[model samples]
Target: MGATPEEGAAESAAALDEVAESLVSLWSLAHNAPDVPVPATQLRVLFILEHGPVNVSNLAAEMGALVSSASRLCDRLEAAGLLLRDHGRDRREVTVRLSTDGQALLDRLKVRRRDDLARVLDTMSSPARAALIWGLAQFRDAAKADKGPGSAGESFSLPA
Candidate 1:
């Protein structure tokens, strides 16, 4: 037997609520993480820079933020010695890249976060972990297909 339309709708709504609550919990955990002094926004900027040096305007576009806002974020990261800005080959453009300290910090944070996640996952059954990995992979693929290259919306999704 199939579920009624109303039942299906209710289930979907409940799933969305659960996802929202999980996101809040994740944010709280990240906020309380040790040795991670930067705000989440700055961390995201550093993560992007870690991939490769990008021009300020491009970074702003990718982050979906105003140029001035991105500039302010860059300034804060630079002040923390986590990023470097240098003149581009065009001389008129500025390129932003992560500094060694930035890389070190990111690496440490990644490891710590991975360990924290692993600890939580350890309590779950293997099948549950596999299901999570599979679900997230499918969600990522769907998101990438929906949003073109350089789109930021790939970060959020709900599993069906």
Candidate 2:
């Protein structure tokens, strides 16, 4: 008899964690390269901004950081020409949007990351690569199904 779907998912969770760890390691190394314009946290802010403008308070919540901390992060990014802050409808409210430079930087970082992963994928057997591609698509489908509407899971996708 086959394992129940829940049991199968439970068994896969640890393996998923291992894969996530390895990918994070790769991302950290690539993100910290000397030429990369921003640190990881700032890059995260930039990525979030790339989606669209966000209110200062909401950005803080998204990052799980205090409003002051989020504002400080925005300060550095704005100083670096990576983003713009504007007063929202209420004069006291602040909103942030990624600058053109920030978008370019994010694009470069993504390309670098893809290249790094491609290098690793290049060394794998064709069959292994095929299996990985198929497995990841299935996993993505299942994950999307499990997530509620407008959840961050929607933001997670394999690069083309």
Per-residue lDDT tens digits for candidate 1, residues 1-160, read 9999999979976996788687557534744677687988998898888779999998998788999999899999999999999997778898999999999987877676666668778988999999978976875776666666776356544311
Clashes of each: 0, 0
Q: Per-residue lDDT tens digits of candidate 2, residues 51-137?
A: 799998999988889999999999999999999999967678999999889888888888888889898889999999999889988
* TM-score of predicted structure 2: 0.79
Would you list the clashing residue pairs of candidate 1? none
Model 1 quality (TM-score): 0.79
For model 1, how big is the CA root-mean-square deviation?
4.3
Worst 10 residues of 2 by lDDT: 151-160
User: Which pairs of residues collide in candidate 2?
Assistant: none
lDDT minimum window of 10 residues, candidate 1: 151-160
**Candidate 1 residue-wise lDDT at 58:** 88
Local distance difference test scores for all models: 0.80, 0.85
